[model samples]
Target chain A: MSAQRRAQVLLAILAVALIVLPFVSGSYVLSVATLILFFAFTGQAWNVMMGFAGQLSLGHSLYVGLGAYAAAGLFFHYGIGPWAGVWLAIALCVVAGAVIGFLAFRFGISGVYFALLTIAFAEFTRIGFDHITWLGGAAGLFIKVEQRDTWDLLNLRGTPKMFYFVMLALAAGAFAFCTWLLRSRAGYYWQAIREDEDAAQALGINTFRWKMLAVVISAAMTGVAGVFYAFYYNNLFPEQTYHISRSIEIILGPIIGGLGTLFGPILGAAVLTILADSITEIMAAAGIEVPGVKQVFYGLCLLVVIMFLPNGIWPAIARRLGLKDK
Target chain B: MSAVNGSPILEVRELDLYYGDAQALDGVTLAASEGEIVAIVGSNGAGKSSLIRTIAGIETQRRGMVRFRGQDIGGLPSHRVCELGIGQVPEGRQVFPSLTVRENLEMGAMLRRARARLAQTLEEIFELFPRLKERERQPAGTLSGGEQQMLAIGRCLMGQPELVMFDEPSLGLAPTIVQEVFHTIRRLHERGLTIILVEQNVAVSLKLAQSAYVLENGRIAMNGTGAELLADDRVRQAYLGL
Candidate 1:
């Protein structure tokens, strides 16, 4: 099939999945699905820079926490709806991401140093938030609870089905945005810079500006996911929301699925999340309890995936299915 | 006021360049006129790349004046310097490896052209390098060394540059490929493009350029018309080895 046809088919399948997911799931399953969708959304955002643009960010949770905190703090203080908070969250993330992107690229900090800088920024943000009592500090802040029904769309305190659907929408949006960016001129610029920045510059690509664009867009999308996470979980703690583990969880999908490949993040998320749940179930069934087994599993999964399938599972599957690159 | 021809398309005066306390280029003066092919030949560590890079604005000169079209561009950024109509086919044929032959060419016009003219420019580049047209969608990295070199040259031409500098255009290639590249360079010259070529391969560059300069130990060891240098006993002994 042509690239357009293939993209259309993949998108159609994803649309069908999003529409059908919440109805088939139980409350607990729906909750897990909601989390999965949120991670997938954020993962796609991170993938835009790290995977496609080749500006690997290890501090992606900075944007996530910023988005979540921005929206959550606004809503908590002003009773603003999730719909309104989303924009502010995204805008804030964009500005922050642009700043970080500019500093790194302007100074020519690339490769592992760029990754370290991102991590450092997120850590700094976490520390700042931990002491900021306005957002409930380390204990975290929760929305006000009254006798409202679980389907409070305005308050964003909805049923598992509601959260699942909202998360599905955000995830779909991210996937679509990534698809468009990858296929568009902007995508070409990003990919070119990612492959070889100096060559990109020689080609007259303003590497600084384009990289900033990637950082900002990716950041804005991740921020929106933070808003989604805040509403879905109804709480935000510095450690939990801004944790490095969250950053790792967000990137694993893109890394395992296929860095720079559309649908890679979604597939990676589905694979990693489902396999993780199944592993826990198998462990429980065998009555073999292991300390921090889940963390070990996540690490091992990343390690094994990187060691064997570095380019990603999607490319392997795509090749197996006789699908050539566009 | 150069006595021989049109105003200098590029001029570097009293250029001094250093790489971490090691003076690479010292008091070098050079000028390239419109429609002229000027070659700079030097052996390894003889400051040829440094001179070209300093002129290209990729490396800063501590003391010098670089003017393009009579405008001082010494302080300009590399991309801006390129936007001022200076295109560089850098050392190592550094094409965007993951991009297609077409996309790599598209990047060359990224400075001042639009999406509308991109198709026209792409076709022009394909016309300039037919091998690229054959593999427009193939990853540049996957191309043979000769094809990659063609793609690199085609990419630089897409900018429609007033002045183009090719650094070691024949580096690390088969003799046939090298000949093909020089032939392309000759063809490009026939089309009235200004070029400044930096090379360690002295004989070939001397044959192609109208005027040439030889750099040795951070200074100009020789400078004259290509025929004059070719006849010089020093150039013949050192570079041509005849």
Candidate 2:
């Protein structure tokens, strides 16, 4: 079979396996799978800006936090469902992305400077939310538990199985969206801009518009992930949700997988999440109270990956599987 | 003021460009008519590249007007200039290295007008540079310097630009490869395309050009027909080793 055909077959098999997972796995495994899919979705979103457009944003949690706050706040106070509230979350995140994009691109603030700007915005928002009592301030906010024996898909107060399927659907959607984008005209332009900004401009690609589009689209996608985070966890705290560490978690999947490839983020997230979870379980079973063991393990994994597989684990895997030529 | 045909297709009037506090171009004025080959011959740092860059809107000029097809396009951005039918083969053959040769050509035809004729233009470009066609599937960075230059010119042609500017097309190439590049430029000119060529190889550029200007110290030092400048004493003393 052709490389493309082989990839299609592999992806189909993976999808089938994921679909049948809940039938065989217990609740704990289902929840871990959901977490892995969540990271995959957010990592794909982050890849649009960093991997494709070559813009590094270390403060992506700004969008996630804003999105979670928007949906949870609306649902808590106004009795609005998450389905309707997601629009508000998307809007807020897009605006925030636009503001940052405009200021950064217009003034030629790029590279680490642009990353610093994103961090500053997220930090400012976190501090601002801390003092705002209307949204529970720093004390945290919770979604009221309703007595629903049946699945609640609309309000997103569903069972673990329901949430698992929802996350899988979302991961699939994000994957499809990224695949489509990489083949489209905008994708070509993004690749050109990412390779050389000045050359792209000479070829009649408005770099500013394309870069801003990447930021806005990435923010919007991450916003949707934020909505899922709020509804799935049923709680939000400014520190926990908007933290820089949360942004780091979102990016690590893509970085460890492969930045530009479609399957990189998903593979990276799976490897990271499963490994970390197993390590925790192993330590727990041994009754060894090791502090920051997961962090140390992640750091070591990242180091080994960077040292050996510089482009990421997915590209190496793809090459080995004959899914890609190089 | 001397236009080959009627009105000039591209006209630069007293363009002054700067990089920070340092002046890169000072009162450099020139023009190229439709279907004419105009060469800017100069030594290193003579502002030949800067002149074309300002015309292509890659560099902003502090003062003066860049009129393309009779429109004032001085302060416009590079992409806008490209949209207005001006394309540039930048220095160092900046073909998207990671992209395939076909994809690089496709990127050149990104504008609405060029995109409409993409298929026809791609065929034409492949016919002109068959080496590019042979390596269409390979990444552009893998191509040799001569092939890369051909790819760059072919990519610019894919844009269907009325006016194309080449900056140092022969730079860092062997004598035989430079000859091939110049031959390609001649063929392009013979096909009725307006060209603005900037080069340090004065003799070869002047031979290919109809009308040529000598740029020195960010200023136009002299202007004349190719044969006239070739025979001039000042040109022989400064550019050609007499």
Candidate 3:
């Protein structure tokens, strides 16, 4: 293996670190770990479209919000467990994904226009959900607190360690899935469409169908992350769930880690989670808390990543470790 | 006319195509038979590209028919058209830049063929373009213009297409590489595969073509056997620069 490929192997080994992390850390540390795993999942989900398929979606929060709402509503009222709720959320997200994909790919919207369409869909859903009360208006809804250590696994309620392990498993699964897809024939078409849509189409790529698959996959994955998000936070609100800020949070990991690289989202999540925790702790200790600090931090990180290492940090770190795919 | 024994591989009749408000091809009619190398030569903006694009189903035709293997294909999508054993190496070497040489070729065989058949096709492509095999892992964008053109042709050939359309395959290549591309075309021609070569390199095309058509402003300006066109004083003055 070349230096770069050796680095990817190292990354796969880093999964061991994640499994061991929760045991060594206190509640605060585990909290941060959970956040990292959550965002890493979101990042991988976002990478499905923005990285592999080259479709920029600045409104991924729509899927998250829809998933959270669908799952939470079912669990709260219909007595549905998260396992069933998750599938329902995915189906709903797929329908939404197809609609959005149709509008963007079929109508030939790309780049900034495509980004705008995603944002519009997200914002519209947020407002509409805020008004729809059968689930719960924007006031938000909380889960019924079960007996501590009663540990309802079916309901996705359990020990913090349980949640930690589940999230880790999910993050790993997503990474594997995206990596395999990239190496597959479908991945070839996605990359081709990403690089040049017209060229891909002329090569008989069937750009529309392939792009729709990207959207559906990304949306479905994001929807799964939404279920996890709802369960972890024990709450759901349309405004918070579907907000543009949430969309930014979802993409931050892949953007920082490495776009289109399997390990990039995990790496990006680790960096951002650590940085966000430190920055927040420092500001609180200094008693000079600024409004929207996380947003500002994300913006700064994006700028720095773009200017410093535009391809993301994975290739550089992978280079040092002697892992080159080619 | 004797090329296919009876049936033409592709036939377009009074096809009209428009781009937005501009008429790109106006009532154009053309045909190509199996086992023939048909050349369409025209100056820039002469609708040569549009003619093939219409036949390939990339551009929608407003009037008339595009019959490929006796089926009216004017309404079909490009991918469907491709799956019917007709593949187009579109204008410019649109090699997927991010894809490795091998991956680019693999994607070319993505239609209905199994991996085993595709593997066989890859062997043939490697035999045709050894440089591609040597640089299998390299990104196609980094290749030289000549190599990129060869990769494009090799990629389309990976589809095992019976009827292939090459648009400006000789563009922006060194003279030596241009001859090499023509030789490959000749080899395919000899294998009984039908080919439509849209080229501005009139001499090389005329040398290889059995029949030739001149597209001017989306209309057929002249059509005849290669020998007949070569002998015409008007063709010699305009295209051959006699």
DockQ scores of the candidates? 0.68, 0.75, 0.54
Clashes of each: 0, 0, 10
lDDT of 1 by residue, B1-242 (tens): 23278788888898889888999889898888888899999899899888877877777898989999899999677878888888888889998887788888887777674345777878888887778999988889999988888988988888878788899999999999999999998888888889999987888899898888989998987888877888999998988889
Candidate 2 segments whose C-alpha is farther than 4 A from its true place: A146-149, B231-242
For model 3, how does the per-residue alpha-carbon lDDT over B153-201 read when each residue is reduced to its tens digit?
A: 9888877788999999988888999899899899989888899999999
lDDT of 2 by residue, A146-212 (tens): 6345688988886788889999999999999999998887788899998888788777789999999
TM-score of chain B of 3: 0.96
The CA lDDT at A136 in model 2 is 95
Off by over 4 Å in 1: A1-7, A145-149, A322-326, B1-3, B18-22, B113-116, B240-242
Write the residue-wise lDDT of candidate 1 on A148-230 in tens digits: 34687766775677777778878887877887888887888888888887777776677888888889999999998888778
Itemize residue pairs with steric clashes in candidate 1: none
Candidate 3, residues A1-326, lDDT tens digits: the string is 66656666677678778878888889888888888888889999999898999999999999988888888888999889889999999999999999999998777788999999999999999899888888788888787766557577789888788888888888889988888998887787888888777667666778889999999999999999989888888888888988898898888899889998887888899999999889999999999869989889888999999999998988778666666531
Candidate closest to the true structure, highest lDDT:
2
After superposition on all CA atoms, what RMSD does each candidate show versus the true structure?
2.3, 2.0, 2.5
